[model samples]
Target: MSEQSSQGDDDPGEPLRLSVIVPVWQEAATIQATLQHLASIREAGHQVIVVDGGSDDGTPQLAEPRCDRVLSSGGRGRACQMNAGAEVATGNVLLFLHADTRLPGSTLAALKRFHTSRNAWGRFNVRLSGKRPLFRVIEWFMNRRSWLTGIATGDQALFVRRPVFEALRGFREIPLMEDVELSARLRLVSRPFCVTDPVVTDSRRWEQQGAWRTIFLMWRLRWRYWRGESPESLANAYRSDVRNAQEP
Candidate 1:
């Protein structure tokens, strides 16, 4: 479906129209439930575009029925696929969501309340979708860190006014740390809204890799990246770690 056909006229009192763009790779494990949760926002008149990065796992097939449009991104990177989705988006605002994440039920209404201001970008706080006691502490730190730094992870559902996004030229095409790079640029223009309401992200990665180990690795990667290490090196190291985790 096209954006124009899906959109309604601007009601001065109504929320700004939103286009939620999700970039999916081999995410069949979680895509369906994520789409089902997003369906409410689409029903409320927002556009949901899912960009598939050549997922051999039939992600696009599953997403096509639930989304406004599911496009084959013909690429393998999240930044590339998300930029492709943003290209065809026709709403006043854009939201980049991860397929493993679920937004708050009241998110659209909350976005409506916040987007009316001069503030151009923001993100939701995030909760990891697992029952482990440590997940709560992780969630608190994630929210607090973002509050202090104005940087957002993809799991947080980063959103921005279309114009601001265009000005920044979207996420840089990189193998990793694209969210961090974009957040650094965005903060120069405006302070992020840092909505306290949280989006829930799948914690399977942490569970698979062991929570403490994953946390330590992530901090090490961030520290290196901030110290100007190349993303290619970081991505290679990350892939190696995940591969090792899956080996035995």
Candidate 2:
């Protein structure tokens, strides 16, 4: 489907309209459920756009019916796919959501508060879907770390005003750390409007690789990234680690 030609009005006096942009690859299994969960947002007059990164599966086909627009990323990578969706988004606020993440029930109310507040960007707190106590510890740290440093991961449901997003030129088309990179630039504009409500992210990765192993792997990756290691190298290392974890 073609993108909506009109860019929605950004009049300060008007109520904020959220445009939730989801980037997907081979996520057919979870795409439908994710979109279904956003039905309330759509019913409230918000828009949902799904960008596909050349998934050979029926991801786009499955998503097209559920969203306002389904665009081809014409390539892979979350940064690139999200940028493509943002380009055609008509809402004043753009929310980048992960395919495996579900926003809180109070999302609209939280966003309304954010819109009225003097903030340019923000992210939701996040929790894993796992019921284990370890998941609670992970969630606590994730939320606390984001609150202290003002850096947000994609799983946190990052949202920013369209103008600010445009000013930053959207997420950099990097192989990794795109969310962290964007957060750094966004911090120059304003402290993040941290929402107390949490988005629930799938725990499949942690379950598949083991929670402690996954946590250490993520910490090592972030540490290396902070040390100025190339994103390309980090991405390779991450993929290698995942592959190794999956080996029986």
Q: What are the clash counts of all predictions, listed in order?
A: 0, 0
Q: How far off is residue 16 in model 2, in Å?
A: 0.8
Candidate 1 lDDT over residue span 1-248, tens digit each:
00001123434664588999999988787788888999888888889999999989988898889999998878889999999999999888999998888888879877776566656788888999999999999999988888888898888999988999999999999999999999999989888876677888989999999999899889999999999999999999999988888896
Enumerate residue pairs that collide in model 1.
Answer: none
In model 1, the runs with Cα more than 4 Å from the true position are 1-15
Question: Which candidate's lDDT is highest?
Answer: 2
Quote the lDDT for 183 in model 2: 98
TM-score to native of every candidate shown = 0.93, 0.95
Off by over 4 Å in 2: 1-12
Distance (Å) between predicted and true CA of 139, model 2? 0.6
lDDT of 2 by residue, 75-188 (tens): 999999999999999999999999999998899988877777777899988999999999999999998898889899999999999999998899999999999999999988
List the global CA lDDT of all models. 0.87, 0.91
